[model samples]
Target: MARQTSDCPFCAIAGGADAHRVWEDEQVVAFLDTRPLFPGHTLVVPREHVPTLTELPADRLGGFLAAVQRLAGAMEHGFGAAGSLVAVNNRVSQSVPHLHAHVVPRNPKDGLRGFFWPRTRYRDEEHAAETARTLRRALGGSS
Candidate 1:
C-alpha cells in the first residue's frame, strides 16, 4: 500500500474525514467534488495513497477503473444526463497528489463550451446529499 501523507486532502477524505462520499469499497472511494462542474460531479480514487495512474498497482487498476465506470453510469442514470465527461490528471493539474478520476455529468450545450473549466458549487449540504442519494440509487445501493 502507498503511504498516506498527512497533508493530502484526498487521503484525509479517504480516511473518512468530512467528505460527501457517495460510494466506497475495500479498494476505492467515490465522492462528490467540493467545487463541482455540475450537480453530480464525482471523483474516484484508490483508498491507498497512490500519486499517479502509472504508479497504481496492476491488480488494483482494474477495480479502480471499474469504480469509475460505475460512477459514470450512475451520473447518467441519476441526473438524467446525456453523458459524462471522464478525465484523469496524472500530475499536471492534479490538485490533489493522490490519483483521481473525474466523472462530470454532461448534457447538450450545458454551457461548458471548451476545455476551460467553469466550476460551480452545490446550493448546500442537502443539495449535495440529494445528488449523492440519486447516484447511490442509480448504483443499486447506498454505501
Candidate 2:
C-alpha cells in the first residue's frame, strides 16, 4: 500500500474522511466533486496515494481505469445524460496533486464550450504531421 499523505485531501478521503462518496472498492473511491461542472460530475481516484497518472503503477492502472469507465456509464444511465466526458489532468489544471479522473455528464448545448478552451487548427498539414511524428517518436514508435 502507498503511504497516505497527511495534507492530500484525496488521501484523506481514501482514509475514510468525510465525502459524498458514490462508489468504492479495494482499489478505488468515487465521489462527487465539491464544485461540479455539472450536477452529476464525479471524481474517481485510486485508494492508494498516487500524485499523478504517470506516477500510478502500471498494475493499478487497469483497476483505476475500469472504475472510471463504469462511472462514465453511470453518468449516462443514472444521471440521464446524453453522454459523458471522462478526463484526467496529469499536472496542469490539476487542483489536487492526487490523480483523479473527472466523469462529467454531458448533453448537447449544455453551454459548456468544447474542451473548455479555444480550439485552433494546425498551421498546415506539414505542421500537423510534424507534431504527430514527434509524439510517435516519444512513444518509441515508427513515425
Q: Pick the candidate with the highest TM-score.
A: 1
Highest lDDT scorer: 1
Give one digit per residue, the lDDT tens place, for model 1 in 79-109: 8999999999999999988999999999999
- For candidate 2, lDDT tens digit of each residue in 1-143? 65788999999999999866677789998776766676656799998888899999999999999988887876676656899889999999999999999887789988778667332455555544454344234323455
Candidate 1: misplaced stretches above 4 Å?
none
lDDT (CA) per prediction: 0.90, 0.77
Q: Candidate 2: misplaced stretches above 4 Å?
A: 117-143
Q: How far does residue 38 in candidate 2 sit from its true spot (Å)?
A: 0.5
Pairs in steric clash, model 2 = none
Error of 1 at 110 (Å): 0.7
